[model samples]
Structures are given as structure tokens and as C-alpha cells.
Target: MFLIVEESGPWKVDAVKAGLTHSLADFRIVESRVSSVETEERIRLLVLGLLTKMSRVRPNNSASDGSSVDCEGHVGYEGEGEDVGRVGERRVNMGNKLSSKQKKKRKEKVASSLQIRNDFLTGRSLTTEREKCYDPRDRTLTFVNGDDDLDFLCEDFKSLRAKMSCGHAVTPMSLTNWCRRLLDQGECRFVCGQTDCHVEWPFEEVCKMALLTKEEMEYFEKTLFRNVAQDYLDVKVCPGCKSRVVRADLSELSVECTTCTAAKKRPYMFCWQCLREWRGPAPRSDRCENYGCINQPLETLRNCLHITFNDVRGVTGCPCIRACPTCGLLVEHNKTQCKNIICLRCKVEFCFVCLKLTEECLKSSTHFQACSTGVAPRQTSIPVWQRK
Candidate 1:
């Protein structure tokens, strides 16, 4: 049994000298004064004072060996013996264990304090103080009623003036209505409402500027992802389950729907070109087995009449309607702007004459001049569902 005293008081000079000269396990008090009687008397007085204090705080129980134990498990004996030194060693070990636990707790607290959370859109770590200061709504513009320089024509343009990343200003209500219209019209990208600006907004920034609710944001993300997937991949909705499925082999028109097959316990296949039940053979590319199964967009691209550019000379015999090289959406030239036209669905700009990307066409020819390769031949090799 050991008596454990928490070290709280200042150490005396004699106690310090004794600690330096003796082993930590030794509990014997050294005699510093030449008079032995005075030293013994002082030791007796110190022991009596400690015992009195301990008796006031704890109930004493005697051990079988005549040592007194307290409720806290501290043991005190009335004699100086070898057992006392062993008790001191045990106290030191207990103190070391307590200090180690305290150090571990402190380290854990520091690690937790330094931890940071990442922003979903920017992929940047944000500290608690910096996160509190972040607000997307702070990006706004004030519009005066009589300001003639303003070009916005919407009714809520004055009430809701939110500035976009492109430095163009738009109203919240107008932005939401425009974006909703785009989604409803099968378009995925959100562009500025300003005429000729056509700057596309990032999805995350659009959500912030529109102040969309949770449900609206979820719907927008889902629809936008589906529309973009269709533009880039050979995807079609299953007729049975209505689940979107991608065609692995673009050469074949038949696409298998795994979800429907699992539910019905039979292999289910559908026509990628028509979105109807597969009635034809395994690998037909021209048309599915179903009667009158044809790619309408491709037919429109192939048989559309040719139109002459009224404003630009030497750019005649171009197709009146052309499929966007990126998304395959049919777009008719307005005949008023340069031969370059922007697709409404995918928001891609391409040359109406050459049916190629506007950037590539402009490398060799001017905006209104004839394409370097002349009008591109009808694109018959690539399927309507596949992008360039």
C-alpha cells in the first residue's frame, strides 16, 4: 500500500537537496541540522500535521498488517521501514501514468481544433471562421428605375438584380424562369439572357445566383446530368422501367435494359433509335425491326433543303437545317448573323456552311466567307445518337 500526495506546494531547500542526493524511491528524511534532537522533533511535528489533515478529510481503516488505509486507497504507516520506500516508488509510477494520459488528451484536442471542412464546389478547405464569412448572395447589383443604359427587359429586373460571373446582370425571377425554360426545352447549359453575350454559367454558380431551394436544386442537377449524358453518350430511356440506359456498342441499335430484365426475370431489349421494344434482329443499324422505325433527326439532316446565305456571297447550297456536330440537335440558320450559328440545346457554336466547329472553320476562313473545304458533305457515317 502507498500514500500518494499530489505535489501542489513549493519545495523547501532541504527537500530539494534530499531529492537530489537520494533515489526517487527513498522516503527517508535527511538530517540537515547538527542537533539530532531538533531534527527528530521537527520530523515528528511534520508527520503529526499530515496525519491530522488526512484524518479530517478521510475515514481511517486499519490494514491487517497494522497500516492505516483510507477510502481513497492511500496507506499511511506509523514507522519508518523498507515498506515506506516501496510505497514512494508506487506513487511515482501512478503520477507518471496520470501525466501520460493528460498529454494524450491534450494532443487529441489540438488535432481536432486544426481539422477543416472542404467546400463542395471549389474543392477548397474552409476553416470555421472563413466559412462564416462566405456568402454567395453578396454578389449583386443595384438597378435604378430610370437608368437608360440598362438593357434588361424583364419585369423583375429592377427588384432582383443578381450579377453573374460573366459581369452581366440578371434578375432572380428572370434567371429562374429562363433556366426552367431551358430544362423544359431539353437544353442542359444555362447561358446569359443578354443578347449576343451567351456566356454559359457553371451549375454550382447558377444555383447560388438563383437561390434555388433544395428540391429545385436536386431536380436541376438530375435533369442537367441526364441531358448532358444524352448529348455525349448513346443513352436512351427504357420503355418498361423508364430508367436511362447507355448503349455500349454504338454500331447496334438494340440496347438491353438490365433493370427491367431483372424485374421481369427475362432479358429485355429496346431500340436505341426509336425507344420502342426491340422487334428486329440483334445488330441492325439502319432501322429497328419495328415498322416505320427511323431516326427523325437524322432524316431531317439528310433530306433538308439547301439554303443560300442571303448576306454572304459564294456560300450557297448549304443545308437549310443542320444537326449540331456536338449534340445532334437540328438547328436552322437565321440567315441574319454570320455563317456561324449557336445550337440551342447544347449551346455549341458551329459553322453553318461546313458543319464543323466554328473555331476550326475560322482558322482558315472569315466569319462570312466560304468555308475552306466548301460545304461539308452530308454526314451519313455517324449515327444521329452519337456526338462528333
Candidate 2:
């Protein structure tokens, strides 16, 4: 006789026992009571039935923590934990493997912002490779039609064609000369010289378009820094080392040259007004001990030549060079443009004829017409010394 036992959740044990029986083969007969062939076949059939029922049972879907219950009422978790760990590892690896282009792009973004101190002291390049949208070396000029106008401010615009950001075609030589002219004229903003198209080109963009060399770029930056510094601060060139120095105390004319003092191993100072070695008292706003130590800038303001406007009439006794009312920086008029000129230093627009704010001047008369009050008397903040 054979005894067949059935249980509610004994499928796991039964499956393991069935596996052992198959592996042990004839040894299973010696380990237990010998049974008939029919009894052994019945046991095999019963184990198979239990395994089929367990395989068909579905895992519980109501578990909230990604855990499921099997037919044996035990908890088993999903593979999401392993997947999340793998994703975190991938993110960490990606952070350390940034490409060179990505790093360069990040650097360029920071360089684009204006830093006045950095620009004035160490200087900033107006031209960088990232700003070079149009390179003549790798690019050829494209003409829309045979009727393209090549009339730019530069005479050499016709030869060695290269298009600027403003859509005007210019040669490298011509672009260089034009930009240099603007800088020499104390123009901080580089505007397109093409007539009727006064699009302002960024400094970096201009550097690339002009194909400036290292020496040319340095010169441009230096000139730009000098122009900007002269507008806002009382800057003077050190007589000892010829390095540009800023006056810390505007009330005192004497300025110490740190560069020269460090080089000479002693204190070195210069007269701000005279641009010579400081010979007078420690801190005197007026003239130094040296004879004829007058303010040259003030003298220029008092004795500058009178200007005559080309288009506007009835303008007389207006100085060709006028001091900016705001910053007192000397600005020269081209005499070919309108009566009103913008001060490059202070960026204040005033009448070159009436010497009043553009808004106040325009209220009384048109740009081409004479000012309501003829030429205004020159206003100088510094008292001009009469020549003895």
C-alpha cells in the first residue's frame, strides 16, 4: 500500500524532493520502503500536478513597495532597485567626461560678460575664435547677384571680399584700417562704416572679422583701455616707466607711481598737471614748485580753434574741441556731421554749436537749424590760468 499526502503550500518542498529523486536514481529505492511500479508512477504524477498549479498562480498586485507575494505567501521584490543604482552610476561617470568643446563653451559664456576692472587692468580680447563667425581663411565670399554694392568706408573693400556681421562686404585690410581709425578717434563702440547701416559690431566679432594678429589685438585693447580710462577716471602716464596711472586723490595733483617706486627701490611721484617729477609740496592741487606747471588740458580748452559747421548756419565762435560737460574730457568735432555730437567718454549728446543737452537744444530748433541761443559760452570746471 502507498500513502499520498497533499498540502496547501508544500509545492516548493515537493519540487525539491522530486529533483533529488531524479538525480539519485536507483539509490532512492534503498533509502525508503520499496514500492510497486504503479505506486512510483502515481507519486511522480502527483508531484507534477502540484508544480503545474504553483506555476499558474499569479503574484499579488496590491503590494505598494514593489514587492509581490508568491503562491507560498512569501514577499519577492522587483529589479527596480538595481536599475536605479545603475542609472546613478552612469550620471556620475558622465559628469567627469565633459568634452573639450563643452569646456570651451562654458568659458566663452563667462568671458562675454563685462568686467570693467579686468578690462582696464589686464585687458580683454575683442576677438576670440568663438566670436569669429566669418573667417576668410576657410570661407569664400558669396555674392547674391552681379549688382552687389561694394561701396564701404574702406577704399580696399572691393578686393579680398569678406562679409561682415552687418552684411557688408569688406577686405581684411580695409576693415583693419577703418576700425583703427574709429579707435584713434576715441570711439569705443565699433559701428559698421557702411553708409545708412550703422549696425554696432561687438568687439570680439570685430577682432575676428579684421583678422587681427596678437600685436594688433594688444594695441587695440590698450588703446581702448586708455580711451575708456580717460573718460571716467583721472588717468595719467607715469614719467618714470611710461605706464598709465590713475589719480587716487583728485584734490591733490601729486600721484605716486607704484611701478616706478618698486623698480627704483624708493618712492617715485609725478605731478598730474605737469606730467613731470614731483618737486613741490606733498599734496598741492594747484601748480607744483616747478615754474610754468599749468594744466595743459585746461589751456587747450581755452585756446582751441573755433569750428564752423558744414551744414548748419549762423554757428560761430564754437571751439573745434569741447570738454564734455559731465566728465570734462576733450572731444573734437568732425565738423562734417550735425551740430550735435555725442561725447565718447560720457556718452552724453550735446550741441557742438550751443553746448547744451541735445534734448534742450532740439526743443527750440531743428538739428539742421541754428540753435535758439547762438553759440553757448564755454564752461570749464578747472579755472584757466591767464598766460603772463
Candidate 3:
């Protein structure tokens, strides 16, 4: 009988090989070289089980000599072997969503259950043919469950990710915008849909998801240093120095600076993910002290302190949008780019409230009545009705 390893547990190749020594004797032990995806998966599971069992059998934290024990593919406190468990076991992170097992069970339940389609809901199924869900406009899943089964679909199917830093709802269509705007928007809050545990997630977790989902990430995962005893999945952003010379490989430096080629180099170091220097003017806002900040370009002070989720946990209040101190106008507390906000009245560059240049005020056809004039503008000029 073919052996099947459980989710977290790996299989022992030696055991399997030994078991089949006489009986089909030629059975191949699973390895990384397995050509098929299915075969590779099976092999990984067996190895996981094998590695886990091996670690349990020998609880010693190190090789006998203990000159700083460096077990070939192991990590953790050398003296503390109990902490080490399965090899390369990916802990199910229930960040704003249920665990992977739970999600799989839910999907299985949906597949096995008798679903009554809700025709009016308007969408195709993700499991169905691609042409069905191909709606050019919204570019979303629309409806994964059959329209008739829409009502029957579990409410937990909503693993919808939101835009980074803005906290705006997102879909596959908005994925592009999410990556683009992440830097513009500082740490965002992603609220879970479970309703009961409507917890909010931090930006780091969001980036974690992004890096995990990255197309090139799989190739990178293969490059990671694996530990056969303790299981962990830590993804480091690809090393790219956004400065006078950007290095593509991340192995060059653990810390990097986020700066451009032209702008004045600011002292702010790059964040582990975004690679942007943390020079935001918002108070209590610190820096990402990664390496390579010396090459970055910033307009203001370079913040070099790192902030944890707990650091910003109780912190409430939107970041202060400051104005130029001299003009008594609204200023950007931390933004480095000079906007085109022009003060039509002051004739300098500023919107009445903030003495800052609007990056492009004239090109903006939107309404901006001077808040001071008390003249509400429908489009641009003060509204005739509100003027009185």
C-alpha cells in the first residue's frame, strides 16, 4: 500500500525504502528531483515527516562536540532541542482569515454539499470555465459559486484583500493599484470579515502576503536555507537598492536604503519590504534602520528608528498633514515630494489651508474653493448660492 503522510508530518524515505526492499523493491525514494508537481509534493510531505521524526528521536540540540552545534539543516537554541519540531513546517497563519486547513475543509464542504444557485447574484464560478467569469469591467471573481448556489455559498469565502495603507477594499482587479499605492499609503489596517473576530492586520502582514504571492517568490523559496528540525517560513524582500545603483539580489545586504538617483541622499534607511526610507514627518513615526540608507535621497530629516505593531497599537489619529510653518498653511508632516498646491490668493504655491504646491493644480479640474473664503465651489469658483 502506498504511504500517505499527514499535512504537517513528513514521511521517512529510509523507512519507505526499507519497507519496499523486497516487495516492489524498485520503488523510488521521493526527492527534490522529482519531475512532476504531484510527485514533488508527495516527496516533500514524506521528507517533512521523516525530518520531524528524526528530530524527535534525537532531542540533543547539537552534534556531540557542541562547539556551537551546527546541525547540517537545523536551527534554534543549541541547548534547547525541545523547541525544534517538524522540518520546514509552515505554521498556518490565520491572519485576518481562517487557517489553511479550515479553508480547505470549507472548500471541500462546498464542493460536496448540494448547492442551490442564486441566479440574480450575477457572477460565474471560479471552479468553472474561465470564459464564464471573464468580465472586462470589474475584473473580479464576481461570483465564484454558481449563481444558483450563491446564497448557499459560505460567508467565509470573503478572503478579499484590501489595498495597502489605504484600507480600501480590493479585488484581483485592484491588485496592480495595491502594489503601486503601498508606499504612498503608510501602514494600513485590514479588517477581517469573520464579523466575530473582526481583527485589524498590520502593514507588515500585508507585505508578507504580497511577497508570498509574488511570481518570483517560488524561485526564491527554493533558495532559502532550510531547517530540518524547526519549521519556519521567513521571506525577505529581494535586495534592490533604489539609489545611485540598485542591486537586484537581496543576498548582498540584510539592510538596504530606499532612495532615488537624483534627489538629495537622506540618512533614512530602507524598510525591509517597501525599501523606502522612513522620513515621514508624522510624529512618533520612526525609521526602518536597514542598511544602505546612506545612498538614499530625501528632502527632510531621515528617520532611523524601526516601529513594531505594538508600537503603533494604541496609537489613534490620522497622521498630521502639516503646512509650511511660515505661511500658516497645511503642511505635509512627512511627505518629501513638493506638491503643486498654488495659493491663488497669496500667489505663492499653496492651497489656502496648506501652503504647499499642488503637484499639478491647474491640470486638476476638480473644485477647490478657498476654505477661508467660506465660498463653496461646485467645480472650482465659489458657488453663486453659497457666496451669499
Candidate 4:
């Protein structure tokens, strides 16, 4: 067998090189002299690490060698044939001086791989060759061991996406292509953590609801969530039309333009059912499309088709979103409760007079008899009226 080794201390170098020739493949025993202080020294360390791993995979022969441990352990020779002085010599033996440069480059590659592994195990975002998978929320791609240092995979979520559905609360960049995968294998319901009120609610937005900020988004990186009943109200947001939500005055609603209720010409409220626009003070409490106030004392609010309701307490300013007509506030939907109308804002039924929700009529009162077109009293029971 051919024994190859660096010219090191005469005794150590010859013995190990000789032992390897007898017990291991002749081509396997290879070594070289590298000064401990030079860049080449690090290369030697890497090679040593590789050698240790390789030895484990292909065990050394014990019968030909002194002992199994001895074969695996150090076999440093220490005589004149072994050249210890070679360790201090510059690695200029290669005919070309540029050889050192090539060796240094190889060492750098090894360092980079070790670093990538480290970052992945610590839950930090690292880019691979194609996409960025690290978002502040429940991103796709199940990171191995919570190690996120993938630097070669993932892509632009929007570009790669194929389609989407409601209540997923998917971000603008979320991939649509994965929609099929998510729906087919969705293990948990995605929840929105906008506030404590929506503590456990579905994250999907309806009618173009706004998303949370970056900082707020980070708060739920690993949290699993779900929604219940009409819990969406807790996550509601007032779309700041033209960024004019704060300074607009709500008092002179009569003189204001329908599209320009607030200072910045923001539509005060949007009819969820018809998508009609409303200006000034919003309904005190009612489902957006259900209306009893349409014929109530307040003529200003009569145009709204929303169903009104009182809170659970049956008082004015009702929190109920569906099946209530006594409230002035309108909810966008009607799903979780009975169709009976209850008024919480005025603490009274539609027959009782409380004007909190009655600020939007063209005339003084919304009574059908008061209209220019004579009233025909039809006993049609609106859904909200039954809930009352």
C-alpha cells in the first residue's frame, strides 16, 4: 500500500503513515504540513474534522492494526523520517504561489455552511436561492426543528400564489398557489389577533378590511388561533377614508355631501348590504341592512336599510349586530343570533322614541305616513322586528 503523509517528526509521521498503509486503503492516508498561524492551518482543521467523520463511517481494520482504539486514535511517529520542522515551513512547496489563494477560498465555503446551520436552529430568517419564507405570522413552509436558515428555497408569495378564500386573513404577499395545499391539509383555523376582543377569532377579512402593522404582526409568530360567534366585531376597523377619520366633524351632517361627510370627504358609513354610502355619525346599533329606524321618529336615518338592535341588556347603544331594529348602529352581517329587534342605545323598542340612531333622515321623522307619497300600513314583519 502507498503511504502518503506530510514530512513531520520522524517517529510520529512514519509509524501512522505505515499503520494506515497496512490497515486502511493506501489512497485514504493523506496528510500535509500547515503552519498553525497561517490560513492553511484552518484548512488542516477542516480536513481533520472530515477525517474523523469519515473514519466513523468506514471503520478502520482492527486485525492488522495494534488495537481498534489505536487504529482510531493518534499514531504520531517521532523519529528523523518524521519531519516536525515541516509544520513551521511556509506551504510554498506547490510550484505555483497562487495555490494558497485557492486553498483559502475552499476554507471560506466550509465556514459559510456552518454559519447557515447555526442561524436556522435559532429561529432567524435567512434567504435561500429563490424566495423569502420568513414573515411575522404563520407562514407556509414548516421549518425543520424550528430552524429557519433555509437559503435556497421559498419565493414571492403573491407571484407564486394561485388563489385565495375568505377568513384566511392572508397577507398581500401570501402565495395563492398554496391555497389548494392549505385547504386540503389545513390543520388549524387561522385566527386574527388584532386585539383582546378578537383574542380567538378567524383572521380572514371581509369587504376589504385593513391589516395590522409590522410590529403588531410580530406579536403572533407562532400562535395558533380560532374565532367564535360574531367575534369579528371585536376585530373591526374604520377604514380611514383618505386618512380623514380623526378631524372630521359629525354635527352638521345635513349640509354635508353624501360622499364628503368627514373633513377629508370620507364616506361616514358604508351600507354592508347595498354598499350605499352614508355620511356623519354612524348607526348607534343595528345590522347594516336591517332597518326599523327607516320609519322611526328620526328622518335622517330612514334611508339606511340596516336592522337595528339593543345590546344583551335591551338598552340603547345595543352591541347586537343582527336581528335587532331599535338600535341606530348597523352591523355588516346577521348570522349568530335570532331575528328579534332589540334597542340598547335608547333602552327602548322601535315604538319608544330615542334619537341616537335617528340622525340621518331627509325629513324630521322616518314615518311612512309623513312621506310625500301617502303611507300604506302593510304588516310586514322585518327580521329584526321578530327578534324584538
Candidate 5:
């Protein structure tokens, strides 16, 4: 028998040779030494017993201390135990906890995705794509029906205005301008544009449809009834302020304007028939007893004497071509030196640049000295026939 021992750091290896004892060269290696094998088996048994005791004791200790013990491969209160069993148990528990957290996160992600889908399908989402239907810059309302959508650029303004009078749809400012043009063209009556609809609208109703302001409506009425109608215009020009006035029915021939009365601070009445100052009740006569006055009808005087709507050159066809600043006679600037015009009726010199008396012009002949004529005039879009 022979024994061999090998040492590698902390580990020991023991071998024994045993044979039939015939010759020394005929021995064969059999097994480890009995003492070494018995020591290794005792050590394994001790380790297993310590692991079992630790597993059974750890729970009791944790319960008493009210805290969990992490004993994966770590020595505890008893100093040493089996590391493999503790490590295996820790790995299993850790995997279960991680899987539970991962499942919860996945469920939350799915729920958020479903909420977004529902908002989009139900048309509750606020998105940029939906804002293109209307422009915020225009500040105009859109007309939307189940199938119809009308933006700012719809049908023509005159056509829309005809429809708007019957409350079909709202008309924009451009449509209002068309309505005004039609009124200016002597079309006082309006009818609904819808098919088979015969709703006649008055001039005041057209003004309402156009959404004119109080001042604008008054101006329009004055222009339509007082200025445009030649034979029917019953208004007289106030000598005090040049404001127009219409006589009340069945009233006396005396006329007084609010503007004249307010400015003069005393009672001021004029003869309605002759436009002369009414100092006292006068016996009815063919004309007012003003000096050098011939009896002429006030309506004839107010009427435009020679209204030529058309001309050879469209540029010179404006009915209000020019009026004499001195005597209010309508005159056209046809000759040279027209800026320094001399009114034949009044025999007064007037400056065309400032439309003031040319006597105020200095002796140096600077007729337009104080005039701010720097900005060129803008061309009119209306044709010659429609200028009136």
C-alpha cells in the first residue's frame, strides 16, 4: 500500500494504492484514503444539517424582529450555512416580483392607448387639422349645414343680398356694398332671390339687411329722397348752415331748421316758398317781398337744371363736375386758367385749388400757396353714366 497527498491552496487531495501484494510494481490505485473520505462526508452532512436549521430558524427570527432577512449566500446570526439553497430561493422570489410589476406596466400602457383611440373616434380631440375649415383672420362666421359649407367667398353679393332680406343667410360687408349700388341705381323695391318666393322688401328693410348704422341710414335717406329726386324733392337749403330741410305737411309757409336755430340763439324762420327771412306774418303774395326778388318755385330752384348723364369722354361726365364757389352755379372747368375761375353770375374770383375766394390770393400770384395738393387724386371706379 502507498499513499499520495496533493495540496492546492486551501483544498487537499489524498490517494491510496492497494494490490494483491505479489510485487511492488504490480500495485494499482484504488480509492481515496479512508480518513480523508470520512472527513469529507462528515463535513457535507454538517453543512446540510446547518442549512436545514437555518431555513427553519430564519422565519422565527424575522417574526420577532418585525423585518425580512435576506440570507442569499450570506452568513447570518449562526455564522455559516448552505449558500446554494439560499441563492436559488432568492432568484425564484425575485423573478416572481419582477414579473408582477412588468404585467402591471403593460396593462397601464394598453389602457392609455385605448383612451386615445376613443377620443379620436368620437371627434372629441383638439387637433390642428380641424382648424383649416375657418380662418381666424377674417373674423367671419361660417355657414355649415349637414352638407353645405359656405366660407367668405360664396355667391355674388347682390344675389346673396336678395337672399339675405328673406333671412336665408347672413351677408358680409361686400354684399352690403352691392345692395347700396342697386339702391343708387333707382331700384327702390327688392324681392327675394329664392325660387318661387315673392317677398317684396321696402327701402328701409334693405337698409336693415345691409346693417347700416343710424347715421348712415339717415344719410342714405337724404340722398335718395331729397337729392336724387328732381321733381319730388321738397327740401330747402338753410341759408345759415346750408343744411337741407323738408317742410311738414299742412304746416304754415314759414320754415325753421334746428341747426339754424341752435347757432343763431334766437328764433329764425324763413318763407318756405321763397326762402326769405320771415320777420312777421305776411299777406300771401306771389313771391316773398325780398328786394329784387322774382317769384320762382323752390322746387324748380332745387332741381338740377341741366343734368347730362353721358358725355363723349367718360372722364368729364361727372354730374358734379364743378360748382361756382361764389354763386353756387354748376360750372365745368373747360378753359385754360380754370384754377382762377371768375363766376359770370356773381362776378367773384375764386381759387379752384382751395375753393376759396381768390381775392385772398396775395399780389405775388401764389393762388395755391397754402393748399396741400401733394397727394395725387384717386381714380373713380364708377363709369360716367353711373356717376349721379
Candidate 6:
């Protein structure tokens, strides 16, 4: 028996020959139809109906050989068409269905066998001979618990760095980069990365690290020295700029406040002891011209006297060995006045005689008489049995 499908258009003819068996319900065309007015769906339905009719035909009632349907839809027999349809039917039946797992395994196998380009998702192969994976724990590569592992490059911050207090390490370059970024966003502080430590990043320490150049480091060091002198050594601040005056000799009674001196383009001198700005040519005088000023024994005066007196001059490297009874700062004395001395700092009128602090020294004579021989003999020197 022959099944001839009349093609409605070129698509139908091509569809029949190109294995539309799945869409056509396992029925392959026996002979293709070249002309018809029907749609593809209608043509498929018509072919299906013909295949159903062919199945119902009696065994001896087959159509004649090489006979087929024309455009008019007359049925004909083409000897080879029945054989092709039977083969398609057998193929449809014998094609086995695969489970999900089997399909996955087949896909994996095909992927493994194929040489795929590296798109990052699939990893790249190491092409170098020395590209073997190395263990940092290897003794030859790294020491146990060494800083090598902790070291990191921070090009943005621009320096190599050591581990911080909490054992976390980052380069100064990285810290600087992060600091600038955070500061731009109005952040005041940053915490250490070490969770347990939780220490705030110190602004001063970071500033020191960030100042890597020679000029910057020198400036920072000088600034630190000035701060130390002002904060610890009681150096006075400039009344003009509030910067600490550069006093190379702390014991010097006279100081020219450099900050104030630079302004107005003239000499502006001040007393280091009183912090009083000196006026006129008096700063150039042998003594501070300011009356009632306690800085009578100026360091310059003592140095001048040292030139006169060869004896007791070289006894002490510093002409001023006596510290302020109140502030303990060394003050130069020419020994011109009475032993009753008042500290410029703290302004306590303490007797220079035996360093005795007594208001009586300024008023009464008894304290001076008691302190006359310098320090009084130790009370411990007297026998306990003769205790007065």
C-alpha cells in the first residue's frame, strides 16, 4: 500500500522528506505531495487519516506499483514508499528514553572530553613548568608563624608595612588610601581589622608613617620636639602665633619669640622666665631693662661674668646649676641678690638658702638665720635617747 501526501506548499513537501515523524505521530510520508490548498496542520491530519486507513486494508488488497496520488488527491501505489514508512515506524519505537541522572552523566562526559576555552568560570590550565601548586607550610618556602605570610603589598598607600599591635598587618600605602577615602566621607576614626583587638587607628601614628620623605620626616621630628618641650619642659608658646618659641637653651633668661619677631619685620624679643614681650633696645642690654623683673641673673649675664671670673666658671658645665624651687627648672643665677629667691614659674617666694620654702624668708629674719648654713644638720643625726 502507498500513502501519498499532497503538499499544500513547498514547506509541506520539505517537511515530509525531512523527518517530521515526531510531529506526524511516527508516520513518514510514502510519497510527497507537491500541490494542495490545505495548511500544514490540515495536511498532517489528512496524512494521519490515510495512514489509519492503510492499517485497516486487507492483506491481499495492496495498491499497484509506482502508482501515486496527483494534486486532485487520487490514491496511488509507489513500491518504495511503504518500506520507508515502516523503517521510520521501527526507529520511533526502538529509540530508548533516558533518565535524568543518565542525561547529566552523558553531558559531563562530553564536556570533559571537549577542549573548552577558559572563560574564568571553567578554570585555566597552568602552562608554566614551575606552575605546580605550592604549600606555604613547606619549610623551604616559609618559616613557621613567620611575618612573610603576614606581609602584603599596598601600592595605593605606597609603603611596606609591619604587623600592628593586634597582629594584623597592612601596608602604609593601603592605610593611607583607606584613610583618605574614609576622611572624604566624613569619617573620624577607623577600627583595626583584628576583631578581638578593636583598636582605633591612631591618627598621629598614621601621620608619622605617611610622612615617608626626608623633608617631611625632619619637619615631623622638629614639631614633635617642640611639642615635647612645650608640654613637658615648660617652654612658653608664642603670644602671636601660639607656636612654641625655639629655645636652644632652656636656662637662658631671655628669648626672642621667633614667631612674633618674624612679623612686623623687626626684632621682637621676650623674656623666657616671665613670658613678657620685651620692647625697644633693652633686649640688647647686659640685663633685662624691665624693672622689678625677677630675671636679674640672665644666662647672658652669667656667661659674661664667666669670661671675667676664671675661677668657679669651669666648675659646672652649665653656669646655672640651681633649679627653680617650685618648678625644678634650672635657673641661671649671677648671685647678685640675696639668697631669698622667688621662682619665676609658680612665683613661690622660696629661700635659695637651703632651698627652704618659707614666707618668713621674705618677711622675718629667723628663717634665714636657721637656713644660713645652707641645709640644716639632719635631725636623724641626733641620738634618739637625747631627743629634744
- Quote the RMSD, in angstroms, for model 6: 39.4
TM-score, prediction 2: 0.47
- Enumerate clash totals for all models, in the order shown: 0, 1, 38, 77, 0, 5
lDDT value, residue 260 of candidate 2: 78
lDDT of 4 by residue, 1-388 (tens): 1111211211122212222122111112212121111124333533444212211111111112222212112232222222322344443465546567888986896777566444433323354311111222224322222211111134323211111232223323232222222223322233232233222222332111222222222322111111110111111112333221111222211112333344556534543322234333554233233343243323323333433433212223222232224423333324223222234332333321222222332244442212222222222223222112
Predictions: Cα RMSD each: 29.3, 33.4, 26.4, 26.6, 45.2, 39.4
TM-score of 4: 0.18
Q: What TM-score would each prediction reach against the true structure?
A: 0.48, 0.47, 0.18, 0.18, 0.27, 0.22
Which candidate, 2 or 5, has the higher lDDT?
A: 2
Question: Judged by lDDT, which candidate is best?
Answer: 2
Per-residue lDDT of candidate 2, residues 254-359 (tens digit): 7888777889999887888888899967878877887889877777887888887888877778888877665566789887867888866567798877778899
lDDT of 1 by residue, 163-240 (tens): 567776654445666787788777767877666787878666666555454345556655555555545544566788
lDDT of all predictions: 0.55, 0.56, 0.29, 0.27, 0.39, 0.38
Off by over 4 Å in 6: 1-227, 230-234, 249-251, 279-292, 295-388
Q: Candidate 5 overall Cα lDDT vs. reference?
A: 0.39
Q: What shift in Å separates residue 201 of candidate 6 from its native position after superposition? A: 19
Candidate of highest TM-score: 1
lDDT of 3 by residue, 1-388 (tens): 1112222223222222222122112222221110111124334543444223322221111223321211122223334433233446676655797888988997886554323121101122224411111111223223232222121233322223333333334332233233334322321223433336444544244333332223222322222111100111122332333222222332232233333222446443334334454433322212334344442212121322221122122222222342232232233423222222442112256432322244333344222322222211111111111110
**Model 5 Cα lDDT, one tens digit per residue, 46-108:** 343322222212221122232222212122332333353243232133343457778899689
Runs in model 3 with CA error above 4 Å? Answer: 1-177, 184-200, 203-388
Worst 10 residues of 4 by lDDT: 224-233
Give the candidate order by descending TM-score: 1, 2, 5, 6, 4, 3
